[model samples]
Target: MSQSNALIIPGLKVALVPCPALGDTTLLLRLAWRLQAAGACVTVASVSLASVRSYLPGLNIVGGAPDVVALAASNDLVICAIDWQVTVPLSNVAYLAGKKLPRGFNPEQPPVLLAGRVIAGAHNVICRDPKAGKTMVQWIDLYAEEVLGLDTSLPVTGLQDLPAVAEDADRRVAIFPTTPHASKNFSSSGFRRLARCLTARGWLVEFVGIPAEQQKLKAEYPGCTVRTFTDLKGLVDFLSNCAVVISNDSGGGHLGSLLGLRTFTITRRRGDFTWRPGFNELNRVINPILSFKWMGRTVWRPFIPLRRIVRALADVKVQ
Candidate 1:
């Protein structure tokens, strides 16, 4: 808590609805931590409710799109992410805008119908399109300073503290080989290579994914432990005991980083650097070997070699 707590109104209750994605929801945890530190009671709602609750058990969490008007009435302030597509009034409500609208949501006419689909009439709107250039963390810092009257910088802290289960906790390493976007994932063979290397050194390697991905992961990494979590609490509890986590550019890396675990993120391109996990000092981003524009979009080819990833992991003395 580098910033002075005086800037925020003590005991002010706030309700927040973050964007739909798990990664997007986790990015707001920093802001929630700051608010809680200042004695402000914070409630967060997201599609990833179970995951959020697992990461920060201290905060009040609800599921799905809550009634904004009802929340605004109960809480002192309501901060809704613009991606929710809910029209809210300007009074006592602020909007946290994200990168853009959901994909494939285009109106026939920009001026007439666009106004209906977008979130407007908010007294304060942070992270709008003009502000999208900054990284999500940078946007949150700005929100704290300009909106909440906090210090320019603050020490990064996990929303909750998790104690290691036992002496063998450091011997465990969890690898997440899946991402919502297929292109963003590191190669399956690459993860297998890294897992085998770690296993040879007596490090216990495990693979985690959703229930839908469980069978595929088990088949891909035979002879290795594959644990599928129906609930995020189970997944997070499992991760808390692990020493390190390796993941593609997805929610798993973000969750591990939020839990203060050493995380290695495999990103598809250098451009995705802005979205890399950053809460923990041990967090690192691994990018592809080369990237070039193919058609209208950039194509990141041939994920980074296994040797380089291994070298990066070795750089950190995780014990």
Candidate 2:
């Protein structure tokens, strides 16, 4: 289609369906920001309310197939995150019937012949992150730029923007203690040790996590301040106020990096280094030793001492 034709479509809408998790939802929100910049009205559709809240502000939200179809009809383009496999058939039908541009992977890239009138495998249009081979963030940025014709460099809105820092706080430290999988979680024992160390140094530590997880941690660390919020807004609010963030390989680390907070990420292995966040000064990734066999080959690992983590945090230059 011609660029003008694509740009002028009335009610241009893009749907972002995210995995029912805070991290994935955050990635989708970034994509929404890009889409909005590109001139497309973006709606983040998900069955999970938590996921929707985690999305960046200013994007539309839809909960079911019926609404998704109705929304797609009026908009010229519909970009669905691959996580919405349950409602793919309905979405495909809507795109075919409405002649809307459909973007995103479907059933592992189905054959064009069997995929029917819908745009099969348009999901690949959004490039995956080279590190982890996941398209979550890259795709969001791509959809916004390529499909929406929006400028990617415009200051990212929503959670990426931080509140002004408090002048009186002795020190601001962001604590991220959650990970999607056990393997990536920084040891709670190690975290408690670090927390105690920071507290002893008179730094104000802010523990950030999903609401439920934060509540649990608050109960555990009665004296510490823990902000358990599911959405990016609350998370950013806390991160913005912090001078440094110590995180595992989770959404918190990503947010810290994006918001210009100095982020120190603890990883279990180098392979987990994918998506460590760009801009070297704002983000530092520290990998601990772990042995694992890859493709039937044994690999030895080297450990990263706790002293190293502390030193890295000390060296961070807060902007």
Best by lDDT: 1
- The weakest ten consecutive residues by lDDT in model 2 span 92-101
Residue lDDT tens for model 2, 1-319: 4655444233455666655555555566576666666556777666543343433456676654425456455554455444443353453321110112245534344422212334344444344444554333554565555644456687666552335668733278878887767656766677777888766666677677776686678776677788776554556666667777788777777666666667777876463344565432556667756567788944432354557656665654433
- Candidate 1 on 1-319: residue-level lDDT in tens? 3433343566778777777776777766677777776667888876566454755756888876667777777887777776654544345556555545444534221211111233233323444444244555666767776666655454544655454587778788999998888877777888888899988766789999889998899999999999987766677778888878898888788778877788888776453366767666777777767778779866664647556657766765556
Give lDDT per model, in order: 0.69, 0.57
Clash pairs, candidate 1, are none
lDDT of 2 at 18: 59
- TM-score of the candidate numbered 2? 0.69
- Residue 297, model 2: lDDT of 49
Q: Please, what's the RMSD in Å of model 1?
A: 5.9
When summed lDDT is taken over every stretch of 10 residues in candidate 1, the lowest stretch is: 107-116
